[model samples]
Target: MRIPNLWVNVFIIFVLPNLSNGQQLSTKPLKLTDGQNGVKSIPYRATDQCMPKMDAKRGKTTYGLSFRLHSKGGHCDDGLLICYPGMLNRHADSLGFKVKGLFQIDNKKDNKVNQFCSFKMQKEGISAGQTHWRGIKVYTMPNGTENRQTMLEASVASRPYKLGTNVGQFSIHLGGNGTDLLTMITVNDGKAFIDNQANLQKQFLEQFWNGAFLREHTGLWMLGLDLLPSMKQENVKLFIARNCNCTMETWFTQPTDSSDPKEPELPTAGSNNCSIEFESTSEATTNKNDVSDECFGEKHFEIRFKNIFKKCWMKFANACPNQTELIMLTMSRRNGFENRMGIRQTWMNDSVPGEVIRFLIADAEDGEANDVQQKLEEEQAKHGDLVFLHGFVDIYAHLHLKVYGGFKWQQSFCANANWVLKVDDDALVHLRRLAYWTGKKFRPIVAQNPLVFFGKLYHKYLPIRNPKSKWYASKEMYPKDMYPDFMQGTVYLTTPATINAILLHSGQIDAFYLEDVVYTGILAELANVTLSDQKKHFKWRFDHFDEKNGECEDGVPTPFSIWGAEKLNVFEHQYGRMKSIECKK
Candidate 1:
């Protein structure tokens, strides 16, 4: 099943009860006015009160009150609570009616019957006499000064509970059958005021209110809540409000606001630059089972390369008991016979005693390219060095598939090799110097590091957009502004473990046209492999080969691997100049 690209938002709400250690419900009518508008707010009265002390085991308890508000003729605005710190032993009448607006009571549904008020202490450095109170008020105007019965008020004073630790941050972890949720809250130096409804539904509500202190930290809190089992398959919405200095600064509801920075930003529908087109012919449909079995089965190929390698091992067992330390995988085309021969005559023949070289080719499509397929089969039969990926097409766009198959082949047959170098058939390699460098310089690092990937590195490269260009990549193919760090495809080196990692992560990434970008850049990033720059070891174009110059100094420490070197004479000249020079230690 295709995964949908969606964004999610999450919030963390902390509820701190009043330090007086109790709850309260009041019905006495209290008048409040908006300082900005200078108009009387909603008519609400506190009905009940409870001041439960903080528990010794539990660090802090809550104090709250319930309210009964008179229904107005028109719609009622939301309620607000202004808190006064260090107001212990001061009743509502003795407090002198001066309170800083701290908490907001959001009556989004506009329910008119009852409202709740609660407050918690967030200040850590408060003295023993220092107490806090919540002055409750609503946002509705009085109804033409109508005379009504006085609202009944009740206040219950309970025994104080022991106070708990007053830390700056608190965290809670909830684990279920599936994913776990972590919630945390932190305040600077002042007290935190929480509402009564938040206290009641502390397990379910995920909201946060502005605290007393600011300016030091970002007030940044993170919460991860697991979705209900029933809601796991459905979309979820979250509301977020950022209030600055007791005023709502921003209120937004979005589907994709997550507090986790590590969460990968998926491509949204609006930002999707690539579209997938799937074409299935009758031949492909008929061979669907076979293809699936070949690709995903226990064996990844119909014709395995291990048998040929085993035969070669038996033939060379007397001469060399140990397997080759390095294997050069030269990607070749089905019809590039002369290019393969030129490579064999040049660097392939110049390989040291323990090193091995092989060519990789894929089978042609059904009912086409029969001549090229026949020639490939003949070449494979004669040399046994051609690793043919049966039931796969040899196309430029499917180079990733070829490389994947090669990785599987190496894992199966040449698992003991220290390093695997991939190059093109048209390129010439200075294998001797490469061998020297790998043995003398790179071996110690590779011995301690198995995840090292080395080649000519490219970073922040834009995709080719011209349709006529050979490397043109449409926006639909790649949407990012720059490709991830990747080694150039022409020449790159990987160890057995790195190859395994690349193969393991290949399925997680979308298949792209460029093999290097897909495998080395995308899959390598996912696999977390280390990529090193090897520009000194490989060059793209060898148009300027000067033996008298530093290019060939000390036996050409850098291998001259050039593109468009299909001519045998070019390889002969290049190899003749490079063969005699040995890298000076």
Candidate 2:
């Protein structure tokens, strides 16, 4: 998953025809080596002044190719080809070689080119109806051979024939054995196109391999062909003139002991860029309307909350003298008095000694109901656990600020606690079980390694684009189709150190609509915090809970530490039933 810095360079030679002015072509081949952990990269450069001039009207396209090899034998079993337009300079000339090849499979009867090699353009962004490109293909081995093959490809229509610039940029990505011959072509338009016209090709070759060293005498070499523009017709010449740059990275894994031929290949999730479509959307496009005035204000958000928590801790120390081992912070709406009371009567009261529970409420926005603020103040006076954020508004769009405020509060006030469990007021939490897991089971791990986050996790989930959906995220808001690995928002667990890291580095990240994606995905990634999927800790639906089947009769479900019980009756029923059941030794 991670690439290393050391690399081996390999050289590629380009042969250019002599012009009327009599410039000799270079015959020496450029030599470069490959990198370790199955990675090969080559930078683009121009041999002479013959580099392509940037096109003013049409922008340049950048291409990437990734190759992955699973087994030890010298063959390319898996790969991907990616293309992005308008990513590079059009006029600059560089040094690189172009690659052209047929996707072939070795059949016992005959070796033939696969019909699936034809490239198709992929649609970008989250949308209602779009064609899904099958960018990955697997070919089973013929008769006696044990090896299988996989190939991925994508291409675009070439630009129209221009007088000055011929080729803009090209690169090759190769994986597996260096000797597994592939068809390659070389073309030179001469120094006239290079010097006055600023026309030359730029190409890069990157290769990734399995962990072991490949044999030197492997047979995979690219077959090279020469091209001349003068001999070809205008239409055919235009097609050949388009630039190609690709990144080829191959994942090489050790062989498995299973001998069944029908066994499925290992899942390659993040191996290629072909999985997600690239659009021209920027970060500012999606975040334009979502930016709050609170973000720009001079108030130190973290410092203000730190001061508030210090005062609350003093009050808590006088009321309850026991040192709290776990702090549970619930996100509450200022108007949701019923939900807060329902939580307090049921699960909030179930916490054993050495555990603390509290609600985080924010002020109502300007021009809204004044009665909600009056009720929150009364509730804070009655229940000493309420921590109110002063300047922030209690709204769905501003949830990131509220959550960050909670993290800062925990880090400042409850820094001695081993774990901080964040849950919503609508959810049902098995606090006794959570306390046992965090304190008795997971405490040693946190003491040694403190940057751990545990919760129900979402991986590679595409953003919802439907306007009617509650979680609609426009392309302008989030350009990528898939979000990074993030914890589910309903209930998740973290440590004091991770909370501090998120608070310290959170200024660098722009707040998005989804607090889970913003805090756990984006900010956590920037902070280098480790995320873990607690499969049994969080459940999306409570439909499976049946008292007859001892689901609620026992302490929650086997893996479910928290359930999304939005209704008060559902929370009370489950909590009452779980309480009646006896605990096993």
Candidate 3:
């Protein structure tokens, strides 16, 4: 059976107290406005400054709180309580707040305490497991009433206590602990609590609603994540998803030198192994040496292989025509869905003649419907490389010429063209370096083994569950190591020869919903197409940006065509700032 929604979120809302400051004594109860989808955020000032009366070694007290309405009415229900402590946002507004530090509520409810979370923040300095607590609990309604009621509380055992304050607009996340005794007291419905702040304690205990109140206000559900400090250096990313709208942000303790450093060890398959295995005495000793060599050898081997392979692939594809070319083969008569915008934008963006461009627009059935035929005619008129075939027969791009389309073109054009860029309409492509990379040469660039990419053992790892996901797979259905360095769908490419080999072997490949990994990771494995390092492949919006330019460090080459942020104003401003330069040839 599937897990319920409320329970899943309970897992994501783990709470941990901040240990940097002395403990607080009479910290004012931050009235959380129920059902507002609010967030609570506070500044963490870590200084040598010590509290006068409290133990100097304990540090200063610092903390923040977030309030929200539970629902229109109230009820006896349970939810998760999460505390995001030790998140450092150097880029916080002049006042102080990091662009990063979003905490999420999982709501999968499979377990009250999760083994691992996508984002975890810890406060430690060069120590093994210093002051870091990543744990969750269950929070239940305080008292029975007609309206919403709040029941939650957290206590610090340290010398002094700290409370979080608001400079701009930020809210801390609070949910349930494992215990039944609720510490937080809810006041009036969210609005009243904000209005009558002076009498919060009285109103919350007296005017709070009961079970019926919560049931009626289904309210918008929200998700959040936080970045914390661990091992002296803080590297954390947080995300918040509310009402299906997701926003992710990242926070780093401090900025590091931007110059490239000597490469670190290559990521290993079992580096994330969470299992505890025991080996026999004699065998264990022998296995230790073997394991060491394999682990060390694998890391070194991967690094060397990547550098050598990247250079070779760049050299191999340098012989194509000097100019750029695009080929489109369409059979649809008319644009049936608004989804066609994906393809239409690409064709219109850079379809100049004498640029090795070609489109083989065709219709298999002679004008089956009005919409389909109209789309076909419109595209055919725009591009001279239009070809219409009656039946489902495979032909080259043009009627007589076998240029190629779909899987076949992977081979046909790649062999002759400098770069064979193929993309789906739903995707946005960044082509600044693609053209440049294609002109260089490399040894046969191949994909790593999908099984190895996923991990040494295929069916052992599990995905962290979330109530929002409709297609959550169980440990049984997806029992493989989450494939690392898998090719993403939407945008990818390789040399002409590689494409030819992939296309020629397409018949033997089975399709997977995640098409990119299936074709490139699985099928490409048969062709020896290993994973390549391309940091710009896929990324989220709030990941981070160049500190100076404010533009994404790895944004698509084109200004106006970059992905993320549908707001017209933001896109236009960013586009204007992204100075256009001719593709480096």
Top candidate on lDDT is 1
How high is the lDDT of residue 351 in model 1?
A: 77
Candidate 3: residue 571 lDDT (0-100): 38
Whole-model lDDT, model 2: 0.43
Each candidate: RMSD? 26.6, 22.1, 26.1
lDDT per residue as tens, model 2, 78-155: 223222210011211111222211111111111111112212121123121221111122211111122222222222
Error of 3 at 148 (Å): 46
Select the stronger candidate by lDDT from 1 and 2: 1
**Tens-digit lDDT track of model 3 for 1-585:** 322332232232322222244442332332222112213332222211112123344222222233332222112122323333322222222212322222222222232222111121211111213222223221323121112233322211111111111111122222112121111212322211232222332332333332122112111111112222221222222211111010111111111112211211331111111111321111112222232221110001010111111000000111123344433222222242233433344424544542332333322221133355445444433332233322121222112112223334323232444344443333333333333333331122322222211111122223434424533333333345464234444344444555555545545643323334445554566777555645433332323534244323234242222334333344334333333423323
Q: lDDT (CA) for every model shown?
A: 0.43, 0.43, 0.28
How displaced is residue 247 in candidate 1, in Å? 60
Provide the lDDT at 330 for model 3. Answer: 29
- The 10-residue segment of model 3 with minimum total lDDT is 306-315
Q: Tell me the spans in candidate 2 whose CA falls farther than 4 Å from its real position.
A: 1-322, 547-560, 578-585
Instruction: Please give, for residues 43-78, the per-residue lDDT of candidate 1 as tens digits.
Output: 211111112223344233221111122122111112
